[model samples]
Target: MATTALPAPKSGSAVTVRRILAIIGVGFLVFFAFIEIVPFVLTVANSFKCLPAVQAAPQAFIPLPPFGISCQTETGSVRSATEMTDGIAFNPTTEGYQEVLRQNLGKWFVNTAVFAIWVTVLRLLFDSLAGYALARIKFPGNRLLFFIMLGTMMIPGVVLLIPRFIILKQLGMLNTYQGFILTLAADAFGVFLMKQFFESIPGEIEEAAQVDGASRLTMFFRIVLPMATPALTALAIFSFQGTWNNFMDALIILGGNPDLFNLPLGLALLRGAYGDTLRWHTFLAGSVITTLPLAIIFFVFQRYFVEGVSYSGLKG
Candidate 1:
């Protein structure tokens, strides 16, 4: 019996193949990044345009201010469809921001800030404690409680709105800030994240803390929690962003109380505030304002937002 040996792949061919794959991968990445960022860029640009300009040439993303003259100009106004695709430059205007801010928008801003900040702070404390308890403490029905939490995550939040509204009303918490914060204080995802990360920690650390006569609380706060900075930061970002942009919960819980309305809800109602017309520029302005804080925070902190790596210890 004769057996044939296959030819080995050439080094040049392998290198060519790798280069082609690398180019394709980078191309895909750039394409996706562009698409993701384009909406934000358009929002920022359109927020600075006149309503007519926004509706006329939305693709005109470049803003050109008539320096030392006036923001308003004939070039900025589109009189014909022919001009829509002719150029990308339009005179930038602050009218949208001015009008939106003038409509008692400051109050809505405060409301959104209050809701987002309080909820985020409460969630950090409650979720971390709950996570630590579940991850470390071996109480009766501990696994059962954790499983219940996981189950809750599977339930669509929209489905719970009716029940939540009824509960809040029965407790006289509806249309109240306290009720809003309490309801969102400890979400399951936060608990699950912290628990999984906590489990990754070496048990030897707890033993060492015990050897040093440190109480469980002391060891938890001083040792375990400190190491969980990565998870905590991630949790904080998610909580803050979610609460900041949360609309439905705010709407149902607050129940037409303008004082407690968040930015998202307020912005939605702004369409009707104008009556018989949609103000895209004002909407875009509000959107840009709403999106900026989260975007800035993420970009600045992303360098430090690393996955929680398990500690290797008790070595010889």
Candidate 2:
């Protein structure tokens, strides 16, 4: 009977405020989701529309025929025709996709795939070897070299474009795959990423391998490298995406070589530059095709991506 009085029921205004905040939070989430999803939806929808339909109502969610009537003379009398909403006119066509293939989109796809694969593979191997040496092997000037490489990252990428072009031209590599791939074989960022991750591995593991009479190469390949799957996956994804979407470098290096044009370069060439008006429908279709590979890669590797984001390689 003497127990403290039960707390009073929450005030109506307080309950109302909580409800309002919850509603507001949900509304914000929905709004942002809509913002992100709408453009993708519009692109896919419009990709199926004919040029005339897209021009008529670019903002329309559905790729239906434009609201207009067609007139033609029949039996010496004028007749009118209108496409109903549910008519065959609303059906989508594969013309854009067909045209893209005819214009060597498939060749571009293969070129981009091969280029990205080589970049990812070679970048990983070279970066990992350099990172392991810098992190684990004690060599004169190792720290200085790493710091110098890091300093390279601070240089604006644009500043290097002219210099890189000149270097490639001097080597007679311009307009070749070697010109494109060699310059990007290994980047400072990848080396830096691998170094940090390698440093996180316990030295005891390498020491154990040494005690077992393992050579440095054996220790790295058989022992240390096996524990670095997460970091390797992350690096591979980064390299692939960067190389796949590369535009300016590909444009310059592969200059005017239609056979070597990647998706980005091919998409750029898709635009029709007659006096002023742009061919938007065809452009959107090509964009959809180009985006599919990236989307697939991300979805396949999303688990590694998540781990990479939160990975603190070194446990403090």
- Identify the leading candidate in terms of TM-score: 2
lDDT of each: 0.78, 0.77
Residue pairs in steric clash, candidate 1?
none
Please provide, for model 1 over 1-316, each residue's C-alpha lDDT reduced to its tens digit, 9 standing for 90 to 100.
0111336545777767766877898899999999998988888977877666676743787755551223344777433323322378766777778878977677888888888898888888788888988999889999999999999989999999999999999999998889898999889988888887788888888888889999988988898889988888878877888998898898898756877778888887777677878878888988887777777887887654432222112110
Per-prediction TM-score to the true structure, in the order listed: 0.82, 0.83
Candidate 1 TM-score to native: 0.82
Model 2: residue 150 alpha-carbon error in angstroms: 0.8
For residue 138, model 1's alpha carbon misses the true position, in angstroms, by: 2.1
Give residue 126's lDDT in candidate 2 (0 to 100). Answer: 94
Best by lDDT: 1
Candidate 2 TM-score, true structure as reference: 0.83
Off by over 4 Å in 2: 1-15, 56-89, 272-275, 309-316
Residue 291 local lDDT, model 1: 76
